[model samples]
Target: MKKALTTIFCCILLISMLSIVEASSHRRDIYDYKGSSTGFAREKVNYSLFNAENFTGTRMDLTGNSSADSFIGKFFGTFFNWIIGSTSQSYLSFNGTDLDFNETFLNGTIDTRAIAVNATMKLYVDAQDIVFNDSLKSYTDAQDIVFNNSLKSYLDAQDITFNDSLKAYSDITFVNITGDTMTGDLIVPNLTATNNITITNNLDIGGNMTLGEKITFAFGEVIDNIVNGVIQITGDLLVTGNVNATKFFGTYNWTEDSPLLSFDDTTLSFDYAGLNSSYDSRYLNLTGTNANQNLNVSPFNITANEFFGDINATFVKIALGSGSPTIDQMQEYLDNTGSSGFFTGGIISDGGSGTIDITAGQGFIRTTADDNAPLLSFNWSAQTGVAVTDNTTQYVFVDDTGTISLNSNEFLEAQDNIILGLATDEDGTIESVFNLGVRLEESIGQAGRFIRRIHSVSRDVRRGGLVFGETGTRNITLTAGHLWWGRTEY
Candidate 1:
């Protein structure tokens, strides 16, 4: 191995020296035209056994035969097999020469079966055509394409990919491309936009809709011709202009028994129960224009003038005689309106005034006594009908809670008349408490049985004024034989 390497080393040295000597001695003026080639280097040659002067061929040719046997004989065939020099049809002779094709490729084309360029050489195409009917390869710059030596392709015919740079579209359905204009329609199950969206044309939705905050129509009458529906707005729905509708209904359900409507605050319920049991209701209800309403809490009083009712069918036939109402007229009102007025059932408190001022449109009836000791009163202050004529006439008012009284403030000639009360024999317990009497007869009735409001007024008994007792008198008036003189207005 060592001798072989030494021989190789000597061969390479000789070749290098020969190349340097030939290059420096020739082609001294070869580079004057640098634009003629892409390479800047050239070489010249000198031959010992070569004679270009007598060579007859397109390139300098070696004679057909000779010299090889001589070389083999001289070197004992060691240089012979090593291929030093031999003159054959187109080869080197005893003196080695740089073989060149005498044909010029300038203004011409190269005709060859194949071309294997030297690795260090370059085939430049400078402003000229390099006809390649097939793919030209062996590029190493990494930008030029090449096939992988060991990679496996899923499809050999088509292998194309796009990075972020040249891709034109992303997630989309059918795209309407009209010369790059962005006007298109998007149909989706749901859509959300952070900014405002304006629909220039009609947008029809077939399903139910829900909105978070407020939905406003266009500014002026935009929601015109809108009909009412079951869905309602709980919050304040404001409309600045006049709202016309065929009908408007209140959100309450009124019944026949208690037809007047009221509402609960928290639960938002409509309360249609009766206010009390005193006044029986006769309800008449409906909704529309000219609707007559009779459902009322009976004694929602307007100060009455006179009230008339048939004694037999009292509530069935009546009249609200429009005028000023008084405590004297209250009995008439109760008879007509089916109310518990002063003369009959309810207690009538006249405040502290011994004579009740039935002039005002308001009064109170306090029934705070025991069940057996049901006492009624009529109190007053500065009233005109029942004059207060000192302690003597002060008997006009009630003193005991269970006793009948008629109180007055002054001393009179004892001529006060029956002003308010009438002859009412409510189980014969009533008595004329304002009367000034000389003869009287009646047993004090037991509690809850019979109480009397006795009228022993100072009057000419012979003239037969307001009187209340059975025609079969318990006490005969010494003044008159006439019995039951007063008109029984109750």
Candidate 2:
């Protein structure tokens, strides 16, 4: 009974297991054929397997057959064909046609000997890396070729030909030509047609340069006759024709007696000639500090309107207005100006009308005419005893021998007008000479007499007279005299 129950349990577990297996779903693999449940396995999956919705993509998929829509798909579709297409061909093949790229970059050196390219637009090459071993044929059409480094040719006689127009070669910049020889006509075709060569630094030419026109320079300075800019010459200058200048700087010393003339900033100098003869001309020698300004000329002939400074000359002739005036004319001019009045020979006079005239001897008086009678006469040589006439009378006379005489045609009048004398006047009784006063009278028998009434020491009135006798020293006689009065008759 135990064995049979065990068999039944086994059978029940087996049926349960078979029923569970039949209820589960079947799984599809990569090799599964499409459109049929029972078909042969495939080596590759279909395009639908690589679809974005089918796989969980993480990296690049090179072997997939999807459309070139993703980044990895575009890169593989673009460059993979170009790499795998040609083994030994001129151009790459893509999908049985020629392949082209928008831009291609080659990081390594291209073996140009094995492969050549005919580019339509442009071929950019690094001149530093690539070197042409053979001759490159010139293009028929115009093309722009640039060299980053030197564009050198190993040929000994390589020539580059340019077109007549050279239209497109207008603005080629930073071209450095180091070769010494440049044989061509370089033209600059412009509105104002001129071929100008500009150098920024010094231009040292080993040979000579000839110019058909003049040269122009900016304004500069000069030193040691070596001029600077506007024009410069380091040699002497000689002109064949006349030279007109504002000032000349050099000296002119031509002949032996010729005058020397030179000019400077401050002065113009003129010197006398030869050394054999005495040079009387002197020039002003000017210096930075002290300069002598006194001009000295030995012989100078000048006609000028005015003259200045002190003039020392031996002979001088001057024309006053028209001609030379005489001394008398000059004196007349002085008389008109009232400028002539001086004492000469102890006499003074007005220059024009008043003149000194001698009366009798060397004595003088200012009178208008020579015949005018003198009021006083003086005799320095001899004495005269004649009484003066009326018109020609002498009121007083003085001689050199200390003799004074008073002569008049009228009475020899004298008056005791002063009262401070030794005699006192009694009253106004000295009205006339007949009165008892001091008086002079003239008579035929007597020479002259002086009569006067005097007072004695005892205050008595006495009559005294000075009698001019013929020959006597004493001529005074007092009629009634006191002890102080003496009477001497001769």
Q: Local distance difference test, per candidate? A: 0.36, 0.35
Span of ten consecutive residues with least summed lDDT in model 1:
412-421
Best by lDDT: 1
Q: What does candidate 2's lDDT look like per residue over 14-63, in tens digits?
A: 99988766544232223433465675445564434322333333332335
Tell me how many clashing residue pairs each candidate has.
Answer: 33, 0
Leading candidate by TM-score = 1
Per-residue lDDT tens digits for candidate 1, residues 1-490, read 9999999999999999999877665523322223446753233332233211231222221233334223312342332233443333243234332234323442233333123343223444322224431224324334243445323343332333322211234224443333323345546688777667776455767677665434445653222222455334443456769978886554533233434454443234324355334433333323233323443433443232553333222223334445844323444444333311123222232333333323221122234422222223333333333433333324332222223334343231121111222221122232224222211122123211232233234322344444444546475433324533232222
| TM-score between model 2 and native | 0.18
Query: Please, what is the TM-score per model?
Result: 0.20, 0.18
Question: After superposing candidate 1, which stretches have Cα over 4 Å from the reference?
Answer: 1-185, 208-325, 328-490
